[model samples]
Structures are given as structure tokens and as C-alpha cells.
Target: MTALLRAAAGLIIWAIVFASLYALQGLACALGWDKWQIAEASLARLVLLAVYTSGIGVLALLCWRYRPRVSRRQFLDRLAFAGAAAGLFSLIYTGLPVVAASICR
Candidate 1:
């Protein structure tokens, strides 16, 4: 049971980050965060960037934590590491558009 949970942790975190960013984007747009500017970028963009950065940080940490050690030669460990890597890739690929694309439109 624990091994199964560990193997799936990366994907679970990815799903959480993905949903949170989506919800935040909608909330920011509805609240008119685009009207507020900080250093030429809209507040919405800044907030999204911060969240996206945080997500990346968390995924990186998970990847590091789950990385296969020399002594831990187990199938589940390898699967967990792979899952973490995949999750990191997925987060970056899906979240990039949110950071680069126009907000509130």
C-alpha cells in the first residue's frame, strides 16, 4: 500500500497543482487583477507566474526525493522516480501556456 502511494505521489501533486492554477487564473480574471500593474506586467500574470514557479519548485523537490538511490534497487522506487520525472515534464508543458499567453482573454 505504501509503495503504491509513493509511486503515485508525483501524479497526485501534478493534478493538484494543475487544478489550483486553473482555478486561480479564473479567479484572477474575474476579480480584474489585470487592471493592476506591477513593473509593466499585470497582477494576474505575476500571480500566475509565482504559482507556476512554486509548482515547479515542488515538482523538482519531489523528483529529487524520489530519485533512485544506489542501494534502493526496487521496482517501485524506479516507477516512483519515473512518475516524478513525467509529472515534472507534464507540469512544465501544460503550464507554459498560462504563463506566456494573454490573461483574461
Candidate 2:
């Protein structure tokens, strides 16, 4: 149903975001931008963290803006809320490693 698809929109977007960022980190490392300096960190790592943080912010705003509608709509509509949570979790999961690992190695 359209409602279900709508509810799933966040998760779908998160999936794409996750995949794209994951691939981009890999590609950046392969291209040696991982070792390129930005400020105190490598360009690739900074980029990864910045992007992941931005994704979290966007998801948070979307959820907050839609919370009323999601809560007032059918119970099934709460799937959007869940999707937002999952998206946040995935973004954090993907970004955490960047903090611990050397970008180029």
C-alpha cells in the first residue's frame, strides 16, 4: 500500500545513504585521499564523519517533523518512526569505525 511505502521511505533512503557512504569511504581510501590531511584528520575520515553526522541530523529532523502525523495516523504508520530509529542506528554503526581506524590503512 502507499501508506506502507511511505512509512518505509526513511529506511529506503537510509539504505541508499548507508551504501553510498560505505562505498565512498572505500573508494576514498583506495584513491589515497584517506591519507590526505584536512585539519587534524585525514580528508576521507573527516568526510565520512561529517556525512554520517549530517545524515543523523537529517533523519532526526524528518522524524521530529513527522512525529505528529505518524502518531496520529494509523498504527501501521508508526513504521516510519521505527525506520527513523533504524536509520540513526545504521548511521552510527557505520561512522563509529572511522573514529577508531586509520583512514588509509
Candidate 3:
């Protein structure tokens, strides 16, 4: 069970971050967060940026933490590391639109 969880943790975190960001984006748009300015940027943009940055940071951490060590040549460890790398790539690819595109529209 532990080994399976370790292998799947990265993908699981990716799903969670993806869903949370989607929900938060909707909420921000509905609440007119774009009208609220923070540091010359809309509150919605800043909030999304913050969450996106944190998600990236967390995925990076997981990648580092689960990296296969020279001594521990375990298949599960390698899988976990690969999962984290894939998750990081996916998160960046999917979330870039939020940063570059209009929030309300």
C-alpha cells in the first residue's frame, strides 16, 4: 500500500491542484475579483498566480524528494520520480493559459 501510494502521489497531487485551480478560477470570475486591483494586477490574476506558483513548488519538491537514489534502485522509487516530473510538466502546460489569457473572458 505504501509503495503504491508513493508511486501515485505525484499524479494525485496534480489532480488536486488542477481541480482546485479550476474551481478557484471560476469563483474568482464569479465574484468579480478582476475588478479588485492588487499591486497593479487584478486580484484574480494574483490569486491564480500564487496558487500556480505554489503548485509548481510543491511538484518540484516531490520530484526531489522521491528521486531514485543510487543505493536504492527500487522500481517504485523511479516510478514516483517519473510521476512527479510528468505532473510538473502537465501543470505548467495546462496552467500557462491562466497567466497569459484574460481571466473573465
Candidate 4:
């Protein structure tokens, strides 16, 4: 497969997997919460988001390892690229949350 197609597939699968994990984790936390422990607490929400996002990073790395396009020469290069992509995505994804935290503080 071409690099573009591979990237797109990787991204699509990553998105779906992450979204499901996020939903399940959030739901589990909500279900386990006591009446006084609101699901919307800032720190709790942060924990969920952090876990969800880190899960995505780890999944992406695993995907990188299994990618068929990788050659021995290209292995480290591809892994580095995928890691950079994940890092960039995380930075952008959390931008709004960081800004909101700053404004609310």
C-alpha cells in the first residue's frame, strides 16, 4: 500500500479504537462513582482524558510495529514518524483543554 493509504488507514483505525476506549472508560468511571462523586469533576475528567489519549499513543505504536511497509532499514524511521504523529496529535487535541484550564483557574 502507498504511504498515504497506510497513513489514512492507520488514522481511521486509531480514531475508532480510541473513541471506543474513551467511551468505555468514561462509562465505567461514571458507573462506579458514588452519588457525591460527580463524573464531571475536573481532575477526574483529566484522568480519563489522559488515559484515553495515552492509550491511543500506545495503540499507534503497536500498529507501527505491525505495519507491512516497514523494512529493516525503515523500521526506526517509521516508528519515529508514527511517534511524532501521535505526539503532535496529542498536543493539538489537548490544546483546548489546556486553554480552558488556564481560563478557569
| TM-score, per-candidate, Cα-based | 0.94, 0.81, 0.96, 0.35
- Cα lDDT computed for each candidate against the true fold: 0.90, 0.74, 0.90, 0.51
Rank the models by TM-score, top first: 3, 1, 2, 4
- Residue-level lDDT tens digits of model 4 in 33-82: 32224454544455555655665566567565644463544654465456
Q: Please write out the lDDT profile of model 1 over residues 15-101, one tens digit for every residue.
A: 998998899999999999999999999999999898889988988998999998999999999999898888899999999978788
Residue 39 miss distance in model 2 (angstroms): 1.3
Model 3: lDDT equals 0.90
What ranges in model 3 sit over 4 Å off? none
Q: How many clashes in candidate 1? A: 0
Candidate 2 C-alpha lDDT tens digits along 29-58: 789886678777778887888777777788
Candidate 2 differs from the real structure by a C-alpha RMSD in angstroms, to one decimal, of 2.2
Per model, state how many residue pairs clash: 0, 0, 0, 0
Error of 2 at 104 (Å): 2.7
lDDT of 1 at 27: 98
What would the TM-score be for candidate 2 when compared with the true structure?
A: 0.81
